[model samples]
Target: MQRRFLVGLIGANIGKSLSPALHEDAFAAAGAQGYYHLMDLQVLQGRATLESLLVAVRTAGFAGVNVTHPVKEAVLPLLDEVSPEAREIGAVNTVVIGRDGRTAGHNTDRTGFRRAFEEVLGGKAAARQQVLLLGAGGAGRAVACALMDLGVQVLHVFDTDAARAQTFAADLQGRFGADRIRAAADLAGAAWQAAGIVNATPIGMLGYPGMAIAPELIDTRHWVADVVYTPLETQLIATARRKGCRVMTGGGMCVHQAAEAFRLFTGLEPDVARMHRLFNEACARRDAKLAAAG
Candidate 1:
């Protein structure tokens, strides 16, 4: 039997978010019909506006919602309760509102990171492997945790805000150990000569341009992944490709995370390969829109 369609929500530097397309594809793949909306609280007034939107979604019958940056942590107190990992990560990226009208929050970023990373690396990105990470905010925390779980030997974290980067490093060290974490003293000078490098920052996105790290630092020996997929053809990914590094874009994370959330909301396993196809189609559509606008 065909399932009823539902609604979903996402926010961040969402001016270029592909979530609507991704979910639209999911609904179609699952033989469920539904719509996803791109909600920008920045355009609205504040939390009040966001709360009102959430209420409206409930009234209108949204299946579930996906929360992104800025609101991932903020939406915690507003939620009925959250998953243990979401609580531990101090962030939530997916929310499912049940038939009882109760909301449950989950952090799929970490799990998504691991899934995507393993899919590319084909094994645990263990401690013996050096991993360089850009950005110390939510995505950094999620990836760092995933690396630690994989027994990664060391993590080099860098951010323009040195203090923020140091603080996140300290937290990781405190939880994991000093042996597995360190601050990037030199982004150049082979400090990033690691098995993998990741751009956890919002750089290289729509309004944002430029590589998260120096292009000179990228080489064929390192595996590169960026959490940005708006343009999808981000400078980081492009440079990595030129350097012959295996590249993973935020698109993979988007699909895997949503699939997990879909299972939570529907209690049925998602058709992941089909989800990927839908996501790619939606991305193509977005590119067409941008081209037309230009």
Candidate 2:
């Protein structure tokens, strides 16, 4: 009998996510049957919450689910166990369901972001320059750790919520040191002081259609990276590119994280090369569809 697994992704504004296609192809290549469901918060808004969806998926015998966006940090308390790394980062991107129905959460975002940064930027985040990070939320936490691990000398964290940014910086200070990690009070001021900018927030994605930082603030010398993949070339990425700045799309992190999540869900090694190939194809298709719609 062929092995079968049911998994899901829970997030908002994810109607365009290609994770379902990627996972299905992976399962077929490995001779297993898989069903990947998308539980878009945009669709389930009033009907369900992250807490309820976690319970629902678990009760329905789901293998696991990938948590994203606003809920990555919110899902932590709902899990029976969270990996030490995730506990430290205060976010969970992947969860593994045990045979006993116990759920354990882990973070693949940190690994995924790190690998992507090394590949795309050749580890430029480690250039020993002061870096500015926007959005000190779930994804931001993972990116912050990855940046530090890559030898980033100093990191300034900023968010629309001033207190949240300050709190996140305070939490990371114990591990990475207060001198290296700081809460940025001024957006333009932080950008002026940093060498690179990382948007860990959802601002550049589809429904959230605006660059976190202004265009004029991004100079040609500043390298920029955004964690929004839907429109591969987000406004931030495009702005950085036009200024001749090195840039990274969220696609790398998306595919790499999906690969890690697949391994955790099915205990199967993922063909990362295949994922990259499919991801590019999917993006091309998405672009074409958008063009046609217009």
Candidate 3:
């Protein structure tokens, strides 16, 4: 019998997510039967809680599900097991349902961000050896861990919730060393001294439309990256580019992460180049629709 897999994405405001197309197309290219569903909490309208959805999907024989945004951290404790990387990052973006009917949480965000940075930015952003990371949330945690893996000398983190930023820095300090990471109380000061700036918050995303840091804080000396892919060209990215700063969009991260998730789901290697092409096509369609609507 041919192998088949059922996977899904669980998050809010995910109606326009490109994950389904990305993973399903990869499965098609690999000649496997695959179905990717979206469990959008906003769309479900209180019909399901995160716990309830996980139970439903597991019971329905789902191979696994990808967790995102608000639920990435929330889904961690609910899993039967968590990979070391995910545990270290304190977030989980991908979950695998084992044959023994147990769920294991893993994070592809770290590898995804690492690949995107090396491939898209050509590692130029890390040249200064220091980076300013905005938002110490789930995505921020993943990126922070990736930066350490990439050999960043210093990471200055700032979050609207100062406590969250300090906590994230403290957690990473245990792994990357106390001198390598610090929580920043002044975003402008950190951005001024860093080689790159990363926005890991939802500020630049579709529902939340704004830059995490002021455009004035960005300069040619800085490379800016945002994890908000829906807009493709967020205000932060555009501002950075206009200022002659190298900018990496969230699209590359999204595609790379989905490619990793596809591998986890199917145990088969996916053509990442093909996935990137599909992602670009999807983004073009979304942009055109937004333009026509305006």
Candidate 4:
């Protein structure tokens, strides 16, 4: 009998995620049989309930699981061990369960972020230019560290939570140095001073509206990137494109991360081009659904 594989995403507000479709398509393209499920854990509030659900998933023979949002940090404690990257980022997005009941946590966000940055900007985004990062949460932290590894001269970080932003800034600075980091409460005052801008927040996601930063602040001289890929062409990316700024969409990061996860489970390098095509088709389907609803 052939072995069956199962994968799932655990977190709230994942109904809008394209992960299921992407993974399913990759499975088909690879001639593999498996089901990728979206598990909304918001219903299982508190640590006990979440742990119970996780324990159940492991027992049910799931190959692995993907963590997102509110659970990235929460899932850390539940795992038996974590990768150095995940530990350093203080977040985990993928969890693989061992047959002996051991769980290992890993973060693929940095790998995805770096690939997307290099693919979109070629070699122009060197380590000597300032980066105006507009979020300081899990996603933001991963991308910031990825940027530092790529030679970012400075990272000007910000978030609505001033304290959180300051803390992340200080942490990165301690590791990367004071000469390469600065935390800000907001970007309203310093938009024009950076080489590029990145949005790691949920603003401009499918159900969300508006760009995290004002459109007027974007100009032809800057490079812009957003981690929101649901609406591949987010309001921020659209506005930046209109202003002649080079823009990077989050879809690349999404596909790359999912690809790495696929490799983790299947030990095969899936066709990225095929994955990209399937993903674009899925996005189009989603857009049609949204249009019909409106």
Go through the candidates in order and give the clash count of each. 5, 0, 0, 2
lDDT of 2 by residue, 130-238 (tens): 9999999999999999999889988999999999998999999999898999999988898999989999989978778889999999999888998898889898999
Tell me the alpha-carbon RMSD of every candidate: 2.6, 1.2, 1.1, 2.0
Whole-structure CA lDDT of model 2: 0.91
* C-alpha lDDT of residue 283 in model 3: 95
TM-score for candidate 2: 0.97
Q: In candidate 4, what residue range of length 10 has the lowest lDDT sum?
A: 41-50
Per-residue lDDT of 65 in model 2:
94
Put down candidate 3 lDDT per residue, 166-282, tens digits, no spaces.
Answer: 998898899889999999998888988898999999997878888899888998988888999988998899899999988899998999999999888889999999999999999
What lDDT does candidate 4 reach at residue 200?
Answer: 92
Between candidates 2 and 3, name the one with more favorable lDDT: 2
lDDT of 1 by residue, 184-265 (tens): 8677742446888889888988777788788887878888888887777688998989989888888887788878877776
Quality of model 1 by C-alpha lDDT: 0.78
TM-score of each: 0.88, 0.97, 0.98, 0.93
Q: Which pairs clash in model 3? A: none
- Reference-based lDDT, residue 135, model 1: 86
Clashes of 2: 0
